[model samples]
Target: MVQDTRELNRKAVLTALMMSRPASRKWIAEASGISAATVTRAVDQLIAEGIVTETAEIISESRGRRAVELDVVSNRSFVVGVDLGASNVRLVVADLLARPLLALEIATPTATTARELAHWLASTARTSAGDVWDRVEHLCVGLPGAVSQQKRTISNAPNLAQIEAPTFLDDVENAMGRPVGFDNDANYALLGEQHFGAARSASNAAMVTIGSGLGAGLAIDGRILQGDHGLIGEFGQLPVGPLGTRLEHMVTGAGIIRRAAEAGIDLAAPSQLFASDAGPALKALRAHFDQALLIVLTATTVSCDPQTIVLGGGIANSLASTLDRYQAALEQNLRVSPRLAPAELGDFSGAVGAVVAALHKVYADLGIEEEAFVSLPGGDALTHERVQAARR
Candidate 1:
């Protein structure tokens, strides 16, 4: 019974903390509907546990007293985020504050299986962080496929054909000996943008990743639209032109190579297609790219009606100038043109998103629940000090 009460008090205090920034014991007690005495006790315990800290002394409205403000000690914990792209794997270790302490980007060979890849990532994370691995409470991986709602397995990925079977989350957990979380790379990128980049203030937005494959991650009504099947924004497979010509086939780096080859443009690699020299071959390639962007923009506008579209991935970086050219074509095709912008976080967006998701999950597992500041009746709830003083 005591343990239950303590848990309830902890939950209350945590909820109050989440609703606002660092708060005083009086404020927390009032917001949580707990007694000020109980709030003090809970805060003490949390501080001892390294989860909360006494941040500052706020001048009270009272004549001479000062109130101590408590804040969540976010630095006490850390999380690992990994992004598994078709051609590369990137890993980042960040503190609970989501500050990246270490980052590793390695090429992912097509021949490597999912298990092999997971092991490599776990080992790399362990090596990069050196002695700080023990503080890492969660590991989140963003893959290029549908993740099970159970958050355990990768269902399918056409690009990652080597992963024949579902790569279970337990595999990574076992390898790293830590809790693991999984999400789609595109979805993770969207979360990163919302939390830390261009879409931070945008309520409705879409992130289009133009890489080895083209895909989108969408946010609607302030929440990510993962859909029932967890495949809300698989835009790559969307039929853009002929029945066989998917959006990915028309707009991705791979698509550029295929189109350039068809046009007899001498391009050894997709990256070379955007070389500085604007020879006849490069000029012809640019025209094909402009046409592809028109189709992509039209599809994005019609499907989501987002406030803005953020372009990301390997292709976006190489073709920054081409994006301007595409933007002009996009404006011509769209009935209502949403703002088009390059991704703010660049290639690290996916890893950053994974870190945010991991941190949220870690807080959730610790029984920390966030409560809104406003009550349902549109009134401020009384604090514990007020209630206690009234009782006295």
Candidate 2:
């Protein structure tokens, strides 16, 4: 998005190098749509500035010659990803290349209020990140709620109704002295899947996390569709009840249990539900679950036409063996059979998606901005257009 042609050319070349590192100048030019001379100049300038490094000659099979290539220095930069759920919080420290060096989870603050959670987040980050704290240029926190883009405030989180601190985002910044980004957990999971999970190649995909509640994340045309207000994928909030314009009572995992209890059908956690398949609990919920899935799958299919739909979260991961049945039943209602896949990254999708978002901030401008882009691993498949780096 830089206006200057030369600056834009440098950014294009840098992005090309990021996606395909150790790339020759010719490759950089072809991938970035810059003239050979421009690419050469950009690469030369980048190398002279020590922002990019040139590796030893790599043998080129096509040309039958050895050629040196340029690559970003991923090891020098780092980002942190955080996933704060209703009960627990997960933190991951990743290098510029998005490789996780540390990951740990801890219980959330017991107070169950927004201010306490925000304070815990700030203090916990300082403790967990330890020596790597300063190196982390950006921090992305994912949770179950709608976040305002400009303010990074959680106006509404159905599960954590008590959390409503307007300056919570600033609290993290003041605590860490770095840029921070906030987003819903479902969207972060989708970004994680797109970058390193089952949806890596999918241009349009949907991810449904079935845990304490059911939530969804989506990718549209290769970008995370956060909508104008940053809350587009609230599948659990769909109005399925005829009683009023409110969230469907049975659209969540807790809701499922609540509805089942009211109907005199008892159920266990997801693992036990899938254990016998023929177990009475499984049998009892099968019809109801299928009907709800049909509604969800139909909505996702007709609305987004996603090529893949991923299932993840504590419940889904525990009940993964039974996914084929749900996929089969859901496909019965879809116009086209969208490939169903389980989340490869498992429960860590949200945290890793936070990592992906931070890495994206590193990838956006390379060195055009205040903080230079960091080194990241190769095999890139990342998208989230709104993750512009936080300005100082």
Candidate 3:
């Protein structure tokens, strides 16, 4: 019992340092609610393990007491995070502090099986990681599907169904020669925003990605809200209208192209669906787009009651001109509307989010469960321009 109590106190001390490092022992004890002597003992043990280290910088604590600062040994290891989409894979190599050291994007190989895809992702990530590859302690690949980490399986990924299988994660781990993690891409996007993007201050937030397909990632009480089987945010299939048409069928990129074709509009790409002309076909397309988006926003607000709703994915950016309309519609309808905003990270939200999750997993592996949220330090460092600049 004493050992367990001491271990708990150690974790508390470590967690306190993890959240806000370069802190004094008195600050750690106060932050963790652990006694000063216990915190000192735990810090000593952590220093012996090379997990925590005393820094040269010192600070004046309460009553003018001078003490040395301490911090986590973040530079000792690295991790790789991949946002594996159907068309492209975005990878970022980050340190234990969740700061990006490198970022790259590559076309996803047209592999017909999960095994082949796993090999491709592993090799591609290794190449992308470059010099940091050797110190890479963990790898996390976020997929555009419902991921069951416990079962080590992926499902409901229509665009990349070929990569869905029970052993997919194990296959990637075997090929990568390191521990690998998997999760829903949208969930990672939410985490990215919570850490580095617009939703940083929001405890209850939702990230709705309107790209090739529609999906959502919800966070409540500052944690990813994954229901049974990690399927809490599959709001794309929610039906609408008297015909009971699925929401994704009305809002996705493909859906817009198909509808445009049916309406006698020759749309070479989904982006072309939003032309300046207010002709019959274009007007119809815009109306349908607005209505579908409104339905999604309303449903999300009603269900989750998130403090902020971040609109993301490729399509969301394209619909920037119509943001005011959506916000107004929600205000008119709901008693308390969520603060709607565009995804601040632009395209790299998922990739950056994947890095954050990998670091969080590292903390979890170290038994720091109470507070494991990680973030890239400077807000401007995680901006779309900075990430794009790092991309190969």
What are the candidates' C-alpha RMSDs?
Answer: 8.9, 5.6, 2.5
**Candidate with best TM-score:** 3
**Where is model 2 more than 4 Å wrong at Cα?**
1-3, 30-37, 59-66, 242-248, 265-271, 275-282, 367-392
lDDT of 2 by residue, 1-392 (tens): 43487787777777777767679988888877889999998888777766688887788778688778777776677888888888778777777766566777787775656556667787877777778777778889987777778556775576666555676667666766788888888888888887777887788898888777667887777577776566676766777655652343554567666766766766664344445645565666656665666677667766677888888877667656766776776666553567778888776779878887877776664644322222233253222221211101
lDDT of 2: 0.70
TM-score of each: 0.82, 0.84, 0.91
What C-alpha lDDT does candidate 1 achieve relative to the native structure?
A: 0.72
Poorest stretch of ten by lDDT in candidate 3: 370-379
Report clash pairs, candidate 2. 73-375, 74-375, 97-375, 97-376, 97-377
Worst 10 residues of 2 by lDDT: 383-392
202-241 per-residue lDDT for model 1 (tens digits): 7788888888877778877656676545566776666665
Which parts of model 1 are misplaced by more than 4 Å? 1-9, 29-38, 56-58, 61-64, 150-159, 168-170, 271-287, 319-334, 370-392
For model 3, residues 1-392, the per-residue Cα lDDT tens digits are 99999899998898888777779898999898999999999999999988899987564745776688998887777888899988888898877776677888778886658899989898888888888788898888889888876677778888888767777788989999988878899998888888888898888899999988788998888888876576778878787843888888888888888888878888888877666765787887888888888999988887678999998888898877777778889999985678888888877789888887787777776768544553334245455766767777
